[model samples]
Target: MRRRFWLLLPLLSLAGALQAQAPLDLPQQAASAQPAEAADYQVLDFDWQDKSRQREVPVRLYWPAQAASAAVPLVVFSHGLGGSRQGYSYLGRYWASQGYASLHVQHVGSDRRIWTGNVFSLIGRLQDAAKESEALDRVRDMRFALDRLLAAEQGAHIDRQRIVAAGHSYGATTSLLLAGARPPDAPAGLQDERIRAAIIISAPPFYGQGAPEPILAPVRVPTLHVTATEDVINVPGYHSEAGDRLSVFEATGGQRKRLAVFTGGSHSIFTDRAGTGGVTLNPQVKAATRELTLAFLSSVFEGREEGLQSWHQRWKPLLARWQ
Candidate 1:
């Protein structure tokens, strides 16, 4: 009987743990989101690379008009899962206007345009192994594009030393990996060089079982982490987990890093578009996200340090919903 009781004890505890309540006030909690803007940047669209004439990824470069003379700092941006390079134009264009060169890449096979399969399958793209390959490919794409843009023929005026790699969600994962977050070896060819800084927005977890803490610990450059309070698809508590892990690099006293959490903001809020699953809500969330993103990019890329300092101060109060 004691043996039976002991066996049942573990099951009972497991059941209780499984049955534990998840927090309910997600929407209410997410009522806080903020963004600010300054000016408009020049938009340039061009073909980056192609396997064939028919299959080529298009790139959009946003360059601040004011930076035509000076060599502006550069930011290479990747979009979220099921998103195109154009998806986050709101951020790309704004960052360019702030005296930075923003390069937005359209990932082949993984973009929202090619993702017309099952809904579950589409969701799976967020953490798929193939997406990892695409991530590395994106880094390569950035390297290749940098060569073209900086060359005398392409007419680009960008600062090579201040290049930053950034993305949203799975795109954010790509940014981390490019900044030296290595995954288990795949058939992909990803070079671990060239990135000076990183900005990861609501990235999903790539490291599974036995993956070390601070999976992206090798990132020696400055990093900024941005996430919403209610990012359900990206998983619970992930923003904090990533922030904590990346902070190790900061604590060891090497790189400059910061994590900003917005209340009442949803996963899609970080995106330029307002809706994903046919639900439209929270314009405030989107606005705040873009504003902060611009300020961060400007500070890191364009040497606009004062704009970065005034960011949280000017936007914090607006983030609190019903306050």
Candidate 2:
């Protein structure tokens, strides 16, 4: 018995050593985490046809008037339910102004047409969006957008390795799927391996009261989730509260995940479009979104830690919401 105990002591010591050597996964939090005039950027437009999906995806491309270099980062922006590719033009222009090629992709079935004439139909539309087929189609639209851009002549200007998948509300859900977020019963191949980072705003849990662990299980990529204290969507058979958005922030597995919560703001703040259930527009929120989004992207794509650190130091006091 004494001989066996002594032999096990060495194994226990080795186990302790291994445990001590385990990596610490501390999240890179920021108070808030930009584009400027004279940023040397411009916009170009195109309409793409996804023959397989039978969808006409109209895209607005925002890029530097002159290529900054042989390659620049790409950011694809998807808008919320009842939003258009052009809905988030502010983000596209801002990113392009900051030297990225921002591609705004329009998801047909769930675009502005959903709210065109009847606000009463929103619940039905939301239910439809929750269906597996509709969700997968949205992801396919993004993947196909990547394919078209990477295959285009202008594709030469893009740094394929630094692509960002970003979206607002329902669009945020789409971006999550692309960034490896697994909803309750989603299809395979929804995640695009080319996505390096993601920016999701007002994202829904899509877990339906289930444990968020598995809902966000696939979200291993760097993600920045932005939402507001007033970011709540309650309708018949559907509800999206702040907790749902933050679940992504908490459940996503990575040291690079971040979250920014805005006080006295609405979920519509994430979308540039106003009149979204009376979301009073606030420029400060917009500014914070622009600055922090750029900083987050810089941190991941350019390895510019200083910008993130600077954001943490400066905006931590300015922005009321940080976690």
Identify the candidate with maximal TM-score. 2
Worst 10 residues of 1 by lDDT: 8-17
Q: How high is the CA lDDT of each candidate model? A: 0.56, 0.68
TM-score, candidate number 2 = 0.82
| lDDT tens digits by residue: candidate 2, 160-190 | 8899999887788789889987654555788
Per-candidate TM vs. native?
A: 0.70, 0.82
**Distance (Å) between predicted and true CA of 314, model 1?**
1.7
Q: For residues 1-323, write the lDDT of model 1, one tens digit per residue.
A: 21111011110000101111223333342333322345456678887664532445677888787776787787888776566767777677657656777888876655665457677664354344244345455556655666656663334666767788888766776677677664454333453466788887766554441343444555667777776445444232222233432332333212567666655445555676444311323444455566666676666656787866676665564333211
Q: Mark the regions of model 1 whose C-alpha exceeds 4 Å error after superposition.
A: 1-40, 50-55, 117-132, 152-156, 186-192, 212-214, 234-254, 275-281, 297-306, 318-323
